[model samples]
Target: MGREDFERMARAGFIERNGTVVGDYDPRLLELLRAMDLAADLPELWDLFDLMKAVPLLVVRGEHSRLFSRETVATMKARHAAMEAVEVGGQGHAPFLETAGLPEKILEFAQRFASSVRAEAPSS
Candidate 1:
């Protein structure tokens, strides 16, 4: 984004700036954006259940996010019975990871997953 845009976002509380320089756009990032636009129509994404069945899946979503709707989240939970989900209050599109309580919640989830794995492992 341009300097003006960044300044406006900072003023509006969308982001916090710590005197960091932020103007130049990366050519590689532009290329990746183009590639993502070209690959937007991904029908096979619905078949992720087969690949993710054995893995611990966590879906942390912003409550007001426009990209991932509530219906989609429900469908995902229906497809993957073991999926864990959490909604960050009063956030849209994306939640700032540095928000209070977010780190503690993630740590708790990780610890629970590790304990489950240890319990399932066969004794030597």
Candidate 2:
């Protein structure tokens, strides 16, 4: 069922030409990969979810994303009653927040969850 959608994403016609970056592909690609090896000491943050349970949670995912699967989203929703999840259609791996109506959705979420709270000005 998702084959046509997947193929549409793969075809050259699917790419937005105006957004294309004209570059020498190979060397920059190698540099990007090499940069990852410099981060051996990065801290693991998978358990941070437990710490965030006290706050309202919002998860935005790409419909075609392999890294963040629907099953994982379902499990997270099952665990957190306050969690809100939305999948942006026709996107993969990561959706550009500026492209989709993501900014509006995120803004709505913030209003719903945080509008009631106010930060007090610090005493001088």
For candidate 2, write residues 24-76 as lDDT tens digits.
33556777777796748866554776677778889989898999999988878
Candidate 1 residues 1-124, lDDT tens each?
Answer: 3576456556555433486655444558767677676645756687756679778888888888999888988988888899988888876666655564788888888999999999999999
Q: Which window of ten consecutive residues has the lowest lDDT sum in model 2? A: 8-17
Error of 2 at 48 (Å): 3.1
TM-score for candidate 2: 0.57
RMSD in angstroms between candidate 2 and the native structure over all alpha carbons: 6.7
lDDT of 1 at 84: 88
| Model 1 quality (TM-score) | 0.70
Q: Any runs in candidate 1 off by more than 4 Å, and if so which?
A: 1-20, 23-27, 36-40
Model 2 misplaced stretches (Cα beyond 4 Å): 1-47, 119-124
